[model samples]
Target: MIPDATLAALFAAAVAARENAHAPYSRFHVGAAVLSESGAIHAGCNVEVASFPEGWCAETTAIGKLVSAGEKSIRAVVVVAEGDRLTTPCGGCRQRLAEFAAPDTPVHVGGPDGIRRVFTVGELLPASFELEEQP
Candidate 1:
């Protein structure tokens, strides 16, 4: 679990990233920030394209950037949004999170309502996880 201080940092980063969201269709801007085991932070904003299928969610972008940079794991992650209600990771992002985060890994969500809730990656996506067994 990340200390509260780290959570604050990620929260701020997520909020900052939200400003860069490229949503025109839904206009539901969202941001995600992830802390990698290597002590680096990655940020992503949900980008919506006219060809919808080409769009990428903020969580996947952050995780992909971290992994492409050679980070094998993430310590924790925070998500932010501008919705009236608490924003949760979409199913795609949740499944992507399970690939890099262990069941106990922490997921924090926040917005105008404040730090609304925290859940584990496993709790966020509890079914049909595609995890490989370790020796």
Candidate 2:
């Protein structure tokens, strides 16, 4: 289980990032934060473009920042959005996260109110593709 303080910090960062998301096309702003093994938190928001598929997910952006900072291991993750339902990472993000996060790494999903659900990397993608598993 993630510590209360760490969870709070992640949530705050995700929410703040969501507020700055550039989603003029979809108007569906989303933010994500990842806690690295070294205890550093990285946050990023979704960016939408007119080209649709070219835009990246919030988790992808956060992971990019984490990797750019030289952190390769993820301890936990938090995602926040402005809807009543929970907003978890997409399939591609699940794979991206699995690249750096262990199977047991916790992924917290939150709405405007607060966290609503928690899932592990394995739970989200039981058969996540791994390069090492390839023939």
Candidate 3:
């Protein structure tokens, strides 16, 4: 579990980022934030494109921010969306997250009210594909 302060910060950042989502087509805005191992928080909002499947998810964008900053590990993640169900990361985003997140990394899904559910990445994506570590 992440520290209370960190969790709060992540949620706040994700909420703030939702305002910038470029979803003219779907109009389903989403935002996500990741807490890096170095204590930095990276936030991203979903960007949509005219071409279907070309758009990227909020989680992927957040991971992009973390990677762009030279961070290789994610400590925790928070996803916020306006919907009846909790805004969990998609399968592709889950796999992308798994690349940098440990099995125990916390994944929080939130609705308009607040966080509705939380799960470890491993729990969400059981038996994730992992390459053998090379020495």
Best by TM-score: 2
lDDT of 1 by residue, 114-134 (tens): 678888888888884685789
Candidate order (TM-score): 2, 3, 1
TM-score of 2: 0.96
- lDDT per residue, candidate 2, 12-72, as tens digits? 9999999999999889999999999999999999999999879999999999999999989
TM-score for each of the candidates: 0.90, 0.96, 0.95
Against the reference, the lDDT scores of all candidates come to: 0.85, 0.94, 0.92
Q: Could you tell me which residue pairs clash in candidate 3?
A: none
Angstrom error of the Cα, residue 71, model 2: value is 0.6
Worst window of 10 by summed lDDT in candidate 3: 111-120
Higher-lDDT candidate of 1 and 2: 2
In model 1, what lDDT does residue 14 have? 85
Residue range 30-64, candidate 3, lDDT tens digits:
99999999999999999999998799999999999
Q: Which residue pairs clash within candidate 2?
A: none
Model 1 weakest 10-residue run by lDDT: 124-133
- What is the descending lDDT order? 2, 3, 1
Error of 1 at 78 (Å): 0.7
Who is ahead in TM-score, 2 or 3? 2
